[model samples]
Target: MQALLNVILPVFIVLGFGYLAVWRNWFSQAGVDGVMVFTQKFAIPCLLFNAMANLDLGQSFEWRLLSSFYIGALSGFALGVWGARYLFSRDWQDAIAIGFCCLFSNSLLLGLPITERAYGSGALTANFAIIALHSPFCYGVGITAMEIAKARESGGRASFFKVLKAMFSNAMIVGITLGLIVNLLNVELPEPLGEAIALIARAALPAALFGLGGILVQYRPQGDLRVALYVCVISLTIHPMITFALSFATGISVEATRSAVITAAMAPGVNAYIFANMYGRGQRVAASAVLIATGISIVTAWIWLTVLP
Candidate 1:
């Protein structure tokens, strides 16, 4: 109960404020767009930049830890695709889009904040490690799967260059790449510039949370309720269970297990819908899944926190 109150509900309360403001016509969709642009394009990138710049790569980047988390993610994607195609009777392109909803967890907006609240800021190094590779990896798999699906549908070849261009063009990926260059080369920013970035980084979470809630206003649970719930089951339950079992089997540290499981436990991100919309496929299912799964995760995350050590 304390975890629900202290760690979970506070985040949701901030999110709720954003939802209520937008729903009541007090906050314009334009304003929500601006906030999302600031957070996704600038502030959160700065946050990732600073975290990556200062992270001890040798200590944090464990193969076991990464493998445990990613295997679960990949499993979710496979299951999502298979279920959408076989059970729900969606076409290949739409199935791929729905699979992406299971693939991309809301690592930044939900994972970082929730883990930080539960375990303290010092425990975030593993989360950062996971996130550092997250966007690139998820986008790589999603774009490739989508391209292949499109190719099959059109009886044409999938474009490799197109996939690379799309993956590298992401602002988050650019920020992460630059941060890696700095870390690898031991480049230090000037103090004033560092402080300025720190200022922006401080604003990333709360602002992103608010913006996410406002954005969720646009993705109401309208259609494809069964398919949306299928996504929720995979994202909130099965993914984390797989990660937890693997973590225990591999005997990684408790902290790594916590990071892996909690991150896996988050709902599908807005990128799920963006990817679906980009392909003009499964838009309703993806959008509905994001909203419904996010609401469900309130209880689910608290349950995971209780179970984790």
Candidate 2:
């Protein structure tokens, strides 16, 4: 209960404030979009850059830890695709978009903040480690699968180069790549520049959370209630359960297990809808899944926090 109150509720409260402000017309949707743009493109990238630049790569990037989390993510994607096609009768394009919802957890917005509050700042190394590959890996899988699906539907060849181009062109990937270059070369930024990055990084989470709330207000549950709930089940439950079993089987440290399971436990990110919208498929399911799963996670996360050692 204390964890729920102290760790989880505050995060949701910030999200709720954003939702309330938007719904009540106190905050314009345009303002919310600007905040999201700043956070996603600028502030959050700075945060990742700082984390990657300073992280002890040797200590943090454990293969077992990464594999455990990613395997679960992959399973969720596979299952989401299979279920959407076989069970729900969605087309390949829509299935791929739905599968992406299961694949892309909200690692930045919800995962980092909740984990930080529950454990502490020192406990974030594994979280950062997982995040380092998250955007690239998820986007890589999603775009590739979608391209292949598109190719099959139209009887054309999938564009491998286009996938590569899209993956590298992302701002988050750019920030992460630059950070990696600096880390590998042991390049130290000027003190003033580093401090400036720190200042921007500090604003990333809170601003992102508020913007996320406002965004959610725009994604009210529409049609496709059943399929959306199906996505919610896979994202909020199955993903974390798989991570939990694998964490113990692999004998990772307790902290790594916590980070993996908790991150896996987060709702599908807004990127899920963006991916669906990008392809003009499964937009309703993706949007509703994001909103519904986020609400469901308020309880589910608390439950997982209690379950985790």
Candidate 3:
């Protein structure tokens, strides 16, 4: 309870405040435009660059741990596929979106802050590894899911392998590649350059949260309360299960890995929905997942600590 009050609740409180602003008509439906620009133009880039550039590549990356995290996430992905197919009566497109929402978590904007808050900077390396590993699934499998979802609209087969090619070429892949290359090379960015990056990274969190607020305000799940509830479960429940299983089974140092699992499982990375919107794959569903999962994670995280050994 204290953890919820001290750490997670503050984030949601701010977000709720944003919702209040929306309710007050402080901004028209169009009022979010400025904040959106600030988020994309500055915050997100900064956050990504800061995380990548400052990554302590000097610290040993435990391949076993990496494999554990990957497999855990992969398991979530598979479950998402099966759940969407047999349970939802959804066509390929909706299933694709549901799977994407269920599996690909918000490991960036929300992940870093929450992990740092709960477990401290010590857990950062593992968090970094988790977020870094998310790309292949997002761009590769997630995008492919979206493409096939769309392909059915045309009554044509979307070659699964071809979608992999498109996924590989996504901008997120390019951004991470560029960031990693610079980091791995041990390039010394001048102080001024580093300052610029820091300025951008600083904006990522507030902009991301506020943007989330704006988006949720814009897209409420009206007709599909059932679908929204379904999203809340997948986004909040099953995803966390995967993270928890991986953290425990891998013998991860308890505090760090547990924190990672709890928070990462809570929300869909904003980028996931951005990619969904880009591909026109169940954008509404993705948006609702991001919103509701993030909303409920506050209580869920509090409960997780109680069960911790």
Candidate 4:
């Protein structure tokens, strides 16, 4: 059906194109870097702003649903960290890497677009609520996890508040904030500026996805199949499954709740991996985890969509 294709087809196409581009050596890191720069500097801001511009901001947000999702992701992340510590007996860095991977989902690059395609405008708004929570939680919990993990490895401490502030200032967050301001003011971007933002903002997803593909090339796994497998089971399989079970309990609108539930399950959540690697906490492990987790998302997405209410 058109619905499934709209959601499913483009996801693979992007992946496939990324793979081909890499396979053909079409772009260097510099090229990918250029794309990222453009998106982050311009496109992403536009996309975030434009996305908010259309939302009906007055509708009461479902605090319960968002809270449950956030709490569940945090708990799931903590559970993974605890288990990884016991099983791996690894330093905090690796444990935090695993924890962040388990907690974060690919809501922006993959989840939101698909939700928009499948459900419509309101679903996009619902996804926005979930995404708004994602960066703050990931940055906050992730920094704590990283510092805990890193102290053992590097004898250094990470300032959790500093990390939180940095995430709050990230371009995406600024875009969201500014977009909300514009929406609240009942103002639209003027024609010239709006056109530029639209053009640049359109590139954010592709740039991110392509950057993800290129980043995948560096994954060597460090001979830890178990690490990759464990993270996958938690991130790809368990997280969404848990969301669905909770969804069944909530008796919310099936379509909206289902979008959140299944997306939570299928999202690969590359940011966690990025942060983990950046902080010297199992970079290779996080890289491998991200690559494998994202690869699995396509099949898992089909499965989750088919079975979820």
Candidate 5:
């Protein structure tokens, strides 16, 4: 109860404040969008780069932990895709979008703040690893799948190089790459540069949370009730179960295992909606999935936090 009140509640409070700000017209829709863009393109990358640059890479990464977490994510992705295609009779693009909602999590906006509150700052490296890979793996596969489906629609081949180029051009990927290079080579950043990065990174979480809350205020779940319900179940329940089981079976350190499981349990990310909108496929369902999953995750996150040590 203390943890919930002190840690979790504050997050939602800030989120709620954002909702209030928007509703009260303190911040216009354009203003909120601008904030989100700044957070994603600048603030988040700085935060990720700082985290990756500072962590002891050799000691931080455990192959078993990485494998277990990804296996769970991939499994959920596959299940979501298959269910959308066969059970829902969705096309490949829409199915892949749904799968993305299942696999991609709100790692930046929600994961960092909640985990930092629950497990302290030391737990961030694992979360960083997950975030760094989130865009590349989730978006990469999603774009590729969608492109292939589009090609099939027109009787042509999708370009693998195009996918690679898109992935490489991602802001998060650039941040991750630079961070990894600095870490691997033991390159020390200049004091001013480091401070500037840290300063920008500091605002990422709160701003992101605010933007998310504002988005929630706008994106109501009015699509197919059944599709929304399916997304909610897959994101909130199945993802966590697979992550927990795989982490336990792999026998990573208790801390790492716990971090992986909890992070995996977060709601479907807004990125899923962004991707869906980009492709002009299943945007309504994707929006509903993210909103519904976020609403439900409050309870599910509390449950997991209580059950986990």
Candidate 6:
């Protein structure tokens, strides 16, 4: 219990501090945005690159983990779509929005930090292995599906190739690609260069949590309460359950199975909101789902950590 609290308390404290900062107007929105940009473009990329560059990919990579995690993720996504379409009487765009809310875990900001602390940095190799697959599956499929739906609605055209191209151009994807190449070639980063990367990478932790807090302060749950609650049920609860069951059924490595399940337990990714806002479909509902899921996830994550082997 003490060990678990040690892992969990600091995360909430940092997140709480960020919320207090923004709530009290100590950090303006612009200031928070700047910090977020740094975290997204520099700190996170550096962190991922450093982790991947130095690791033994041969031993670290787990196909079972990816398979099991995605199985759960896609399952949750399909459920969200069906629920929104039939249960909530939503159109396809709204269903896709809800589906994304269910599937996309907040892997970078919340999952990475919590997993690093809760399971230790040793577990990070497994978590990053999941992170490597996150954007590809979540954004690649989610964005393409949403775009296709929008185009169909508007009598326009949409292409999966465009979505793939945009997704590959993402900074995190670029970092992951470079890191994989380096790891595959067994390239040793020089001491100075490695230290430089490490210094920048270290900033991701606090920056991400703080950014999350600030963004939460801005999000108002002004949407369909029923739909938001339904999304939360899928995202915060069902997704993790599916992940655990699938991971166990697959009999993956202990570390990979644990990491995959825990990552699946994370709250809805903020990118869900970004996509909703961009498409202007079910924006408020997406925000509401994120808010509710994030608030509820603290308890759910602790429960998962307590119960998981």
The per-model lDDT (C-alpha) reads 0.94, 0.95, 0.67, 0.71, 0.84, 0.85
Task: List, residue by residue over 90-110, the lDDT tens digit for candidate 3.
Answer: 667666666777667777656
Misplaced by over 4 Å in model 1 are none
Expressed as tens digits, the lDDT of each residue in 107-222 for candidate 6 is: 88888878888778888888888887788779887888888988998999998788988788778887888888898888888899989989998988898899888888988899
User: Candidate 1 lDDT, tens digit per residue, 1-309?
Assistant: 999999999999999999999999999999999999999999999999998889899998999999999999999999999999999998888899999999999999999999999999999999999999999999999999889878887899999999999988888888888888899999989999999999999999999999999999999888899999999999999999999999999999999999999999999999999989988999999999999999999999999999998
Model 2, TM vs. native: 0.99
Clashes of each: 0, 0, 5, 6, 0, 0
Arranged by lDDT, best first: 2, 1, 6, 5, 4, 3
Highest lDDT model number: 2
Quantify how close model 3 is to the true structure by its C-alpha RMSD in Å. Answer: 3.0
Estimate the TM-score of every prediction.
0.99, 0.99, 0.85, 0.87, 0.96, 0.95
Tell me how candidate 3 scores on lDDT: 0.67
The regions of model 6 sitting more than 4 angstroms off are 1-4, 155-157
The positional error of residue 116 in candidate 2, measured at the CA in angstroms, is 0.1
Over 4 Å off, model 4: 1-6, 120-122, 148-161, 185-188
Collision count of model 4: 6
Scored by Cα lDDT, where does model 5 land? 0.84
Q: Candidate 4, residues 1-309: lDDT per residue as tens digits?
A: 544576767866776676667667887756766766776667766788787666676552476566556666876687778877888787666787778878888878778666766666466666776766577667778776666555666777767677767678777887878877887888966799878878877777777766666656666467667877788888777777667666667765676576677668755566766677677676666777777877777777767776764
Q: What overall lDDT, based on C-alpha atoms, would model 2 receive against the true structure? A: 0.95
Candidate 3 Cα errors over 4 Å, as ranges:
28-31, 58-60, 148-174
Which pairs clash (backbone N, Cα, C closer than 3 Å) in model 5?
A: none
